[model samples]
Target: MGKEFIEIFEKWADTYDSSLTKDIEYKEVFRGYDQILDSVANKAFGEVVEFGPGTGNLTVKLLELGLSVTGIEPSPAMRKLADEKLKGKAVVKDGDFLSFTVEKKPDVFVSTYAFHHLTDKEKAEAITLYSNLLSSSGKIVFADTMFRSEEEYEKAKAAASQSGFHNLAADLAREYYSTIPKLKGMLEENGFTATFTRLNEFVWIMEGIKLQ
Candidate 1:
């Protein structure tokens, strides 16, 4: 993500939430983020952090788990949405996800429906950054519908080339990142144990637990 892209998104920040959930279909799909958080409530996550918490959808749910949460969102409009929904429950910082270092590393760091927005290089870099912030036994969970296999990605790219949705699909093509296998490898190489496993059909929650 560059400064230019950040500025571009800031312009759309006000209406971005509307774009994501204007229709009933989108509303249900987006809620998957919250459901992911709920599913892991009993995992005993300590202090938590959520990156790219657009509209505070997951931020609110994470706080409800009784874990102190710090949500970092770059877009002002998105942060405002988080503020309105979170209501002082969690700390919200308006900053970039790449280098927003905190004084204390949180026990659990999670993000929902936002990781796809990063470039492949950034995605790999993110795993490194998040790994550095973990406690010895810290856990991380990344939940998104955007993860796709290499074959599916190739098809999507081909479809985009011939279809009128060139721009829209292009974003999806890049934003969705890779399938669970690639993601798992990245996590493991970065010192995370285990790998990506299926949590469900529609949802993919790849986790990494730091080795003691």
Candidate 2:
């Protein structure tokens, strides 16, 4: 879904952590960053498959929690950085949302800040695929930018433009950021009970527990 932005991620790899610290526009987006990572790691259990682990931030947390993590990162540069940071504690390989291989059945599928690469249809497809792959009581925990409604989405874009966050505004317009209702429907259709919690102004933690 977001593979189109691979080049950008590759370029951003080295500066990604710096940007999180220095970028005022993203301050709200990543507010309570550690908390967000901890929340996701806490919800996960057993063998975990983490998609789009940009720089292994959440991967570290998962490992610290004694959860085995298999990270799927599409960007080579990002993978290298993650590997360096991880120090062989976890394996981060080349893969994306729709395609990947794992050694074991994952108890939880987790992602952070990267799922917005998929359009709504693709998001539904991914959810369906995960539902089919996971066993009963498996979980999906993702933290990403999602709005509650189309109107809110529009307002966010407008506000960004008004605030002179041109790049952010453009990103809001260009990305496949989704609405909560749409995501909830997709999870339910795929046989999961869905719930969402707002982690910040721009991010939400979505949890879907597969039915028994």
Model 1 lDDT, residue 139, Cα: 82
Tens digits of per-residue lDDT for model 1, 118-207: 766777898888788788899878776544577766675676566665554555554546676777777888888855544544356767
lDDT of 2 by residue, 1-212 (tens): 47898988999999998888788777888899989999999999999999999899999999999999999999999999999999999999898999999999988999999999998888999999999898679999999999999999999999999998887899899889999999999999999999999999999999999999
Total clashing residue pairs per candidate? 0, 0
TM-score of 1: 0.79
Worst 10 residues of 2 by lDDT: 21-30
Best by TM-score: 2
Model 1: pairs clashing at backbone N, Cα or C within 3 Å = none
Q: What is the lDDT of residue 197 in candidate 2?
A: 98
TM-score of each: 0.79, 0.98
Model 2 spans with C-alpha error above 4 angstroms:
none
